[model samples]
Target: MIVTWAFGHLLGLKMPEEIDKNWQTWQMETLPMIPKQIGIKPLPKTGQQLKAIKQLAHRKDVKEFVIATDAGREGELVARWILEWIHFNKPVKRLWISSQTNKAIKEGFKHLKPATQYDALYESALARSKADWLVGLNISRALTVKYEDSLNAGRVQTPTLSFVRQQEKQMDKFRPQTYYRIELEIEGQKALRVQNNPYEIKDQQEAQNLIEQMKQHSGTVVELSEKTKTENAPLPYDLTEIQRTANQRYNFSAKKTLSLVQSLYETHKVVTYPRTDSKYLTNDMKKTMKERLQAVANFAPEVKEYIKAGATVKQKAVFNDVKVTDHSGLIPTEQRASPAKFSNDEQKIYNMIVSRFLTLFANPHKKLQQKATVAFANERFVFTQNKVIEPGWKPSEDTSETTVQWQKGQKVRPNFSIKKELTKPPKPLNESTLLEKMEKFDLGTPATRAEIIEKLIRSELMERTPNGLQVSPKGKQLLDLVNPSLVTPDLTKKWEDELEAIAQGKFSSNKFLKQIEQDTKQLINEVKQSQKKYQDFSLTQKECPKCGSFLREKNTRDGKIYVCSNSECHYHRRKDPKVSNHRCPQCHKKMEIIEGKNGAYFRCKFDGITEKIPNKKDQKKKMSKQEEKRLLKQYSKPEEPEEGPLSIALKEAMNKED
Candidate 1:
């Protein structure tokens, strides 16, 4: 028997606080927009985690150390990296499981994979860490120092930034040409198209001309076809889909949602493996679905209700043996969660995963899409409508927040009433779609997608303009200066394909590492040798009023600020509008500093007004009398006779007054 103790991921490294004093400083941000780099910082409490891991290793009864993280590349990385850092040298096994119930964990342990089976996975994972360190840190620091601002950069972020930047360029070049579309009302109801599709008039003038012609002509009914099409149930929630739906519903950033979901997975133990790419479960899981459902009766009332009613689980969409890869899609387990264990966001994510899983074995949400064409005079129009005939697996009760508490709800069916027609093109990529694209490109996986999105935004290499995430001027410029491949998501796709080959033992890890090394060498040379034109928009010269010398305005954490280039010259002023710090009367804490075109000013960061401090000379004069009084008072007191120089100054000032 292996002396195995299960604990969370915090056991292997330095506490996030001890790792940097700036951890708390950076935490002051409203969001996780940490500037600098995008790689694993290995969270706080790492040392404690290592102690736990080592403690397990030291146990005499433990025969084999099994690395049982979430089942994926990231999972492998988490456990192996922890082991490596902690000097755990023992025969290791991989305890593979999806949902962490007693049964699932036991089953997983019983069928533990040979440690050697995932050497490729571990290699790829380590390579990713090292690569991110090399590229993300260098590029991030270069940008931050060059700009004198804490700008973020990363392997994934640069490509994401490029996406936003490209969108911006397209928008700038866009000419919003007016286009016209026509809709016809038949009797009281609006008609779209019968068989032929609705028409879009590309030219407004042509559309007007056609409208004029249609007004005179009498259009015959060209064709009318009405058939029901079924919209199958949505596939189960994978990490990507979960992030996507979370973004759509909650407006949470991709990274934020991922964090929430990760917490739900690791903390709540109610949700399945979150970092999976697959949305389908394995064939074997179908047998244990009942047990899994029974296990989650506390957190997921729906599961209990369905089970009590003896409703069978539906299988086609959510679970397919063929679709299951390294891991299956996310699902709930029997690890009972108290309501206290979850935050609001965690509960929401948990609900989503559980609902999708329950719905999968239950039924398909079936609706009949009916299309009809209504013609007015000679002008033809098309009309379409939907009628949900059967909510197969998707009982209305399951969809409703209030449960029906039964497998089958009332016999009510879906009815459709649709009118009006408008021609609209496919919408451009939103965050969710962009993240979906990321999955395809392999720029980042499900775990890294949100992190990349956020990293790009923090760097200002990308921006979320009114339209969407687009690359910024800085991002594009950096892409031009740096190695093209590293800055592009395309490299990830290529590497992932190769890594996949390696995982299957098709390609050698050594060969892959060699290629990465060669590529990195080439990239380094290109960055070093290139004489690219670098520009700082802030460095635009502004003449200083005090010394009649040009002062360089640099962007700082407090925004743009002017500082004299000559180190000896002590001229400095705020560039971006910012109020200065003043001690608040109530809290006695330093106030916020604000800068504007006029100059820097202080305002109490606390909820109160602040007294202003004037120029250096004025401030010195005001403080001089007070400082002298303090010196005199100190000398008069016999507290310390060691008050030598200050006492002499006090005596001289006192004698002059006398």
Candidate 2:
């Protein structure tokens, strides 16, 4: 029988403390907004779990080791890493299934293919890992060194940071300008959005004149039109879609909820997979919905009602064999489960997956729209309204997101007449909406999007705002420092098109990797050639020596410093730097380490205590030595002396006695 590991990573990585000295400082953070990276360190149970994993991986009697992981990239990698770390040499094959029923699992095992078939998938995953390691490690180090602060960086992170900072700038500059328009109203209807322009009256008094003019005029419909439209149930919820929605609805951070969902997939085995970007099942998966639905009869009693409702499971809504690439879209397995082990966040994700499953077989959601134009004072006003004629897959639920839009539209215009005004910001790009946009552009996959967001945050290239992602001051500086082409979404899109080619065996990973390597080098060289000096807002009492211009503190993507006023004129030589993980000795917190005209200093992340590196390191080491200076604990403890001076002296006297 195959053995299992605990719910954790088993190996192929150094122990946390071995990787870095600071990890031994096991003092928990006062504020645990994030799970510390080292907290991922395997526990004692993890070791026992790994022993089981290894024993299973090494069984010679086993004909073919089945890679039975949650069907996604991370799941694949997690299993692969364990096999690699344990040096398991058994022949391998994949047992792929979406649902949790024993029948599905057994069928999948019977249909298992050689593990080598997934080489391309593994290759892509490895590429992601190596690229993240190279870029995240190197760029993060460079920034930390320059800033004398522990700065984070990653491939997706820096650009994501830019995306956010851009929004922040927009928010900062936003000034709401009021506008006025004449609206025509009927006995039962409200006004609609038609032509909007300057008020008929120029001044506010004239605007009051327009309102008065509208008050004097009667309303009449000049034109009317009606149309009907149908929307299939939304495609399956990919990981990013789930993440974005979860963040929006529950105020769960993107990263926080990701971990929760991951556990739901791997540890709980209730969800099919959480890291997959594909939202459609392969054609084969749709065939077993009845069986899949039956498996969950214990928890969601609603499934039986659908079967009773004469819903015939259709192949059209199920998986498309041609569309399935490396992984299939997420779905819940047919496993009956108790919610006892699930955290609140996990329950939300579970509900979403189950609801979507039930929705697939429901009828098509139908919408009807009516648009009308009112001609008054030779100026036209337009009104529009949509009513849901039939709720398709979303039958039981009175409202979903799409439904809300129509509902809100109706609420805003109960009378269905011409409206005076309807002005709203472009739908704010929260985590979910942005991913939708990114997917539309085919910019990146689910596995990579989270990393991109994480990288931007770690690098301080962007940060979370109440509104959404925003670019950091440093992110702006770095974007300007680097060539524009290096950081655009186009870079990933272009790479994705090529990656798709490689997946089809039309191109090679080696060729694409080579091109990317070359591009990265060129990008770095361009940044190095820039003559821009570092600047910090705090460093203001100086002038550029060469330009004789007042030097002001400035913040950049790389760090902080002072530079010349002129952008084009020659000023200074370039220097490289890296971020430190070390905390400030004085403030006992991670410092805002920076490099520049003033050289390296550690400004506390919390306290704003700025100190040089020597002072920082010395303070910590000295503090540790002082804390260990006492022998009182040693004296009180049992079986202490190994070879103390007292023992040594006794040994010499004892030797003479012998």
Candidate 3:
């Protein structure tokens, strides 16, 4: 069997200009430049991969092929498109598995499914890619032309920006209000007075009256209750959950966590697929659970102990075929882990996955929950306490507290006091919370959400602040100028629902594409007709030398640049003076090297100092120790030499040293 791979996508939908030259220039007349025939073009970088696949497919010995790319919708597109482009006539089969364990691979090869089984999935993937192309390219071109600035809009990205903008609006509109709460200490146990709205006593006078009454009267324990509860071990890590946990624990961004986990999967070979959306495993995988446990025992001895203690899989909680799709939860593969061989980030993420996997087989956590209600002056107060009965899967925290035992009809004196507090505004969406929101709204899949967040930051539409992600001025303006539908997550939700239906064979791709086409046209028309105007906030006083257009400041990953505002001109220049590794003699800091008409010189920004660099030919040179000693000896000699052969030899030596 021949093995080959495509460099991501070998073929992509043709650009507007590739279809017709008239559409090349962005103009209102070419507002909705929809292709008459949506043709596929070979990507510039994939020619070699495509050629190799074609050569191998044409071999007489190769009768049939198998698609063994990632087990997801995008993976389906990555392989199917190559075959379509090459017109490979060989019958194809599909290899689908979750974990990269040898056992899973063997089982997958033993039961490879026909490629026809995933035809609907390919259609869904194609529909999504084309829809994004139709909407994103058209709308982005329209906005850039209408606004006269380089702006972008997309089905998923816009909605995500809208989420941040919505949060900002909420924060701006929030008004803080002061409220009072009464804390009562009864029989050395703390409890808070309960009301219709627990701590929101708006009237200060009413709060004072309640506090005075509670201080004077003795309270009685009117009701007491206790119950034992069991909390089963949490399900294993899905990509989103692990990303969230990593962000919360280590402040690792969603993109960073994804990168680390992906490295553990593809590079370290210690973890399963990192892009899976499911949190449950298939029932068929249960037989090899102990073996998988044994593989990771060295990394987690506690888990090994649990397994040795007869820990068994919870069938109902963990093993469910219906809940799994494409791939199972993120897990440790049967490959033995070498913690020292991985980077710190990889080790942290790997440990997280292993911890979750170990917890799945451990016992459930048990706790004793207690509640007491106290009554005084017709006011009800409630207190709750929890004690761990068994620290099952996870390590238990100490919850023991000294409290007076209370019973029904018991009397006790209580001291009460009131504290005033102000309402707090809603917190900004951090990467973790934003990811959760995206997951809830189906804005993007697990694999794409990190990229979406990164795209927003790269576009300067959102920025990372100490508190969380904040909308930039440019982002706010873009939101105001774009159509409302594009900014709302509902559009993405609708598309995702339809795509899932197509994947499940309940909906047709052609119908979905028709709807997308219609929507794209409407969105473009809205942009063309909108009354909103966008001010180029990045515009600078400097003008481009080539185009004589105003230069606008733009930021790149490397540094900032000033570029011509006119898209066609595309004139760009560095904004900051280039720094060189050559150190300054005075301050010893790296000096900024500037080139001029005359020559190159070094300038220091810290001390406001400048120094000239010597010409290479005239620069001072160091002499060797032997040459220095010889020169010193020659200089130390007397002016007159003795009239002898030895004196003559000494004179010659001195001349040579000179």
Candidate 4:
């Protein structure tokens, strides 16, 4: 059998202009550009690859084809589209396997299934692509034309942006209330407020009185209890879970984590598929546990003990066929990895996958929990602590044990103080938190979630800051101006449910596309009729040099740029001067090259020093007296130390201390 591959889909759905000439112009009259039938066209960049595949299919010796792309819906669509585009009528077989290990691939070819079995999956993928085009492109066009602004609204991304906006709104309106709680410091352990009726004082005077009263009265232990608690090991890493963990731990974006994991899967072949949603393994995979563990043990000798202990483990939660989908939870393959050959990033991600897998076989974590309640001045205060009874899977856990000997009705003297705390607002949604919400709502699949997040940032609907992800002013306005349904997960959830049904052959692709077309028309009409006004929030005071139209400041990977607000005028330039190779003699840093009235010049941002770039013929020219005087005058003023918010806060704190 001949093995062939295509770099993703060589042919994509036809563009609007390809379908009809009218769609070349962005007009509300041509809103919802739903073609009579969605057509396919070869993408220009991958045309050569497509031609090679076509040539291979046309060879007389090649009697049949095997679809061996990714073993999921999108993968199925990729192979099927290529075959259809090539117009090959030969018989086709499929090789579906979750992992790319040599054994799995060999077994997959041995049990190759017919291509017809995956026809429904291809249909589902087609329906998704068409629906996204009909809804996303049309609405994005409608909003841009109606408001005369660069705006993008989508089925999944808009809702995801709405989540960030909602979180920001909650934080904006949050009012912090001051509450006081009195804690007793007895033998270093601070007593906690008891549940049901916490010792929280709202009034400062009342809190002070209670603190004084508690200090006078001798405290007595009213209740003491001890119990054993067991926590089961964490389930294996699904794609989303690993993404979240990596983001929280290393501050890696969802896209970055996915790429790293994909490299570990596709390039190194050390792990299973990186795009699974399930965290459970199939029962058949249980027999391969020993070999997989031995491979991991070779790579990470520290986990060898866990692997050995886990080998005898018969944990029911580790394996469940019902929870698995197209692929199982991500785990190390039977191939032992060579850490020295992998990049630092790949090693980090690989360790996370392997670490999670190790936890699956180890014993449950057992701890001894102790609680003590004390009554002082008719108020109850409690303290609870846990000591590990068994390290189990998490041997690195904090197993520090502390013994507190306090019997019921025992009298004790303790000092008390009131702690003043203000209620805190909810934190902004970072990539990690946002992915969790997206997964909870089923906004997108594991493969598409990272892309959906990136689309929002690229569209400038949301931005990442030190605090977390926040919706831009344009995004906040888009949420108001767009159809309300598009900003909620409900629409995408409904479409996804139907798409799944189509994949199962319970729904028709034609009917699904028809419904999407109808919905697109309705959404477009709503956008066109809405009287809500949109302002270019990023509009700069300057006009475009090319078209005299107002230019909007847009953030890009290469820093900021000023793009003409007028949709027709595509004039754009970088907002800042380009940094040149010339280094500032004083600071040894790269200086920005600017075009001055004289000629090209280099300027240092630190001390406002400037230097003229001499031409080749005038390379020996020395600095003139006037230029020397200007430089001295520019640096004459002594620079004051910058006082930012942190500095000012530190000053205020010092004043308070004084």
Candidate 5:
């Protein structure tokens, strides 16, 4: 058997112009450019690898092939596309396995399934690719051309931006409400408020009346209850869950976390695949649990404690075959990894996986809970406290201490106080909370969510702020102009559900594509008939002299730049002043470099002066012998030069100075 690999996607769907000549220009007449059939072509960068795959397929000795890419939807598409492109009619088998450990590979080869079994997965992937092409191209062009500015709209990116804008709108319309709560103190223990369900009073007078009635009143402990509470150990880490935790704990962006975890998987070979959505391990993996634990014992010393305690018992919560999908949850491999070999970021991700995997074998956290209720007049005040009985899996759990003894019907004097509380608005969406929202709404798959969020930030529709994510002015305007259905998550989520259904063989890919085509036409019509106008929020005050169009300003690390807003006009220039080594004669400071119709020159903005940049070739050229001799004869003999008109003028000037 021969083993080969591809660089992610070796072939991509053909561009609009490559598919049809009519869609070459960005005109409204070609709006909603949907091809009757979408075709795949080889990507430029992987041409050599693709050629090699083709040659290997045609070799006489190679009779059968095995597709051992990632065992997921996208992976199926990758191998299938390559095989179809090469016109290979040989028998094909699939090596589907979750983890890449040596044992798993050996087992996968023994049970390789026919590649035809994954046809539904390939069909689903193909349908999604075509839908995105049709919708993304048609809508992006329509918006950009109609607005005369660079605008981007997409099925997933547009809705993701809308989530930010929706959150911003909620914050803008929020009103703060003031309320009062009554608190009591007894024997130095703060008494809680239980008379009001939420312990809040909207009326200040009502609060004052209650305080006047209860002032100087004696309280009795009417009820006392104590019970034991146990919290189950948390399940192992999924990609989204770890991303959320990393974001909150380390302030790492979702993309950064994914990149780090991917490195740990691909480069370090310590963690399993990082793109899994399941949180449970397959039952068959239970046999390898001890070895996996022993592999991380060096890096995470605590794993040894769990192993000694026999904590690796397979609980139904952590090990179940039904919950696992194409890949199991991310976990540590059986290969031992040295901590010193990993980068700081890689170490962080690797530790997270090892830590979460260990938790599966830990005991349930146990705590003692006590609640005491005291009554002053008709109002009841309650106090609750929890003490950790056993730290269990979470050794870092905070333990609350209590020593006071209380009996039912005991009398005591209580101090009452009124506190004012104000309701605050929701905070802006950070990456941590944003991932949670995306997962909750099914906006994108675990593997694709990071990319979708990055696309929004890269396109400038959303920006990262110190507080959280905020919608740009362009993003807000996009929400107002796009078809209303495209702005909400429901529509896209429905399509995602259908795609999953297609993968399950319960839905038809052709039907889904036809629906997408109809939807594309309606979206295009809405964009065309809208009376709303689009304003270029990034436009600068400067205008293009050649095209008479406004110049759009963009910030870069080097400096700022101004580009012509007109799509047809190719005009752009740097806005920052270029400081040169040449010094200004008046200011004696470095001069600004400027290129003009005349040539390169140095300009001093403060002194309002300009100097031509001298050519080094002219200055360094050697003078001929004839030219040197002529100059020497003209100036060496003053008596011969005084007779000449030019020499007489120079002598007159010298006599006047004397």
Candidate 6:
């Protein structure tokens, strides 16, 4: 079988500028430039791959082909687009496998389905991409033209920005109200008063009067209750859950964790697909569960005991086919991996997956919970305590405590005091909480959420702070200016639902495209009529030499640039060292071309080495053919092997063989 691959997507929908001259310039008159015919073009980076695929597809010997890309919507698009672009007429089959394990791949190949089976999936993927292009491009251009500033709007990202901005607005308008509570201490043990609205006395005088009255009477333990509760082991890691756990435990960003897990899957072949949305495996996969468990136990010996004790007790909770979709849960494959072979980040992610898998087999955690109520002056106070009965799956999370025990009808005098407290605002969005909110709102899919967040940060629309993500002034302004529908999560939910329907063949792609076109036009019209204004916060006193406009400092993922604030002028200059194609002589890695006051030189960021390249006027002349030949010969001469103990032994063995 011929194995060929497209670099993700070899073709993309044509941009507005490519469609017509009128759409080339951002103008209100060109608002909502819906293409008469959506066309595809080869992406610059995928040119070689496209050429190779075309060459292979047209080969006379190659009578058939198999599509073995990812088994998801976007993955289907990546394969189908190339075939469409090449107009391939071969009999095509589909290889739909979720995990990268050899066994899974073999099974998928054995039961190859006809390419027609996934036609609806391809349509759904195409519809989603075209809709985004039409909506995001049109609205972004309209906003940039209307505000006279470079701004971006998207179907998924704008709504996410609104989430942050909404939280900030709520915080800004929040009023901290002071309230009072009474805490009674009996024999150095504290208990809080139990009320319908616990300790929320708004008036200080009333709170003081209640405290004084409570002090006048002795306390009695009115009730004591105790019970044992069991907490089931947590479900396996979906991409989102694992990302949040990695962030909380190792401070790894969601994007970083995703990258690490993807590497573990694609490079090491030690884990299943990393972009899966499901957290449960199919029932059929239960047959291999013991092998997978053994592989994990080999790496994490702490789980071996459970595996030895029979780890199939909770199969119902973990292996339900109904809960699985495009892919099964994130899991370790049967391939045994040496932790030493992985990088530190990779090791952390791998270990987390192994630990979570092991926890699924372990027993449920059991705890004894206690509650006590005390009465004084007709007021009741409650105390709570917990003690661990069993350290089950997750011993690290056990938070058992010991407290002074009290029985029913126990009486004692206690000191009473009123404590003041204030209401607090909602916490800012951390990567974990933000991801949770995105999942709840269906803002983006598991595969795209991290990229969406990174885009917002790259655009300087949001800033990552020590506490959490804070909305930038620009992000808030963008949220204020955009149409409410574009900034509400409901739009994304609607589109996502329609996309799923299209995938199921219940909805038509053409109908979805028509709706998107109408929405795009409405969004543009809203932008053209809105009276919102935007200020360039990055503008500086420096003037652009080409445009005679104020220069604005822009920070990009790669580096920084200074560009004219005038959107029309579009003058830009690099403020950071430019990455060069030249390789370093020492490290053989790409070097950066640094321009200093002295001259231009290539510097290796990895090794802190610098080499000066001669100016055109002072460059050395080329050597003659005879001189080149001599130099080449001198450099290519082979040296004799050094006589060491190991080398001598190897020479003696070779001589003996001769």
**lDDT per residue (tens digit) for residues 1-658 in model 6:** 7788876778999988888998887788978889978789999889888889899889999998899988899999989989988899989999988777788789889999999999999999999999999999888888888887778999899988877877778888988888888887765667777778853699889988887888788888888999999888777799999998898888888899999999999888889998889999887877787888877766656667767776574535887888898998898898778787899999989988887777777778888888888888689988877788887776876575766767899986777787888887777778888888899999888988999999999888998999888888888888889899988899899999999999999999999999999999888888888877788678889988887889989887668899888776878878878998767889989898987789789999999899887565554474545779999999999998778999889999999999
For model 4, residues 145-194, the per-residue Cα lDDT tens digits are: 89988789889998999999889989989988888777777788897555
Q: Write the per-residue lDDT of candidate 2 for residues 48-100, one digit (tens) a residue.
A: 77777677666667765678776655566667776776777768888776655
Off by over 4 Å in 3: 203-205, 399-402, 593-595, 598-602, 607-658
- The per-model lDDT (C-alpha) reads 0.63, 0.60, 0.85, 0.87, 0.85, 0.85
For the record, the alpha-carbon RMSD of candidate 3 to the native fold, in angstroms, is: 10.1
lDDT for each residue of candidate 5 in 1-658, tens digit (9 for 90 to 100): 7777897999989999998898888889888898887889999888899999999888999989999887888888899989989999999999987667777689889999999899999999899888889888888899888887667888888888887778888999999988888888877778657753553589778888888887657788889999999887777889999999999988999999999988887777778888889988888888888888888777556778877876475335888888988778999988888888988988888888887777777778889888888887888888877889988778898966765677888886768888888887989999988888888888888888999998887777888899999998988888888888888888889889999999999999999999999999999999999999888889988889889988998755556778898878989888977788667889888898888898778999889699887788864585645779999999888564337788889999999999
Where model 1 places Cα greater than 4 Å from the true spot, the runs are 1-62, 82-89, 130-155, 192-218, 292-305, 374-379, 393-430, 463-473, 538-658
Error of 1 at 157 (Å): 2.7
Q: lDDT value for candidate 2? A: 0.60
In model 1, the Cα lDDT at residue 397 comes to 27
Q: For residues 543-577, what per-residue lDDT tens digits would candidate 3 score against the true structure?
A: 89997889999888868888888777967877987
Choose the strongest candidate by TM-score. 3
User: Residue 194, candidate 4: how far off, in angstroms?
Assistant: 2.1
Error of 6 at 163 (Å): 1.2
Per-model root-mean-square deviation over C-alphas = 16.4, 16.1, 10.1, 13.5, 14.8, 6.6
Question: Which candidate would rank higher by lDDT, 2 or 3?
Answer: 3
Among all windows of 10 consecutive residues in model 4, the one with the lowest summed lDDT is: 192-201
Residue pairs clashing in model 3 are none
Give the higher-TM-score candidate: 1 or 6: 6
Ranking by lDDT: 4, 6, 3, 5, 1, 2
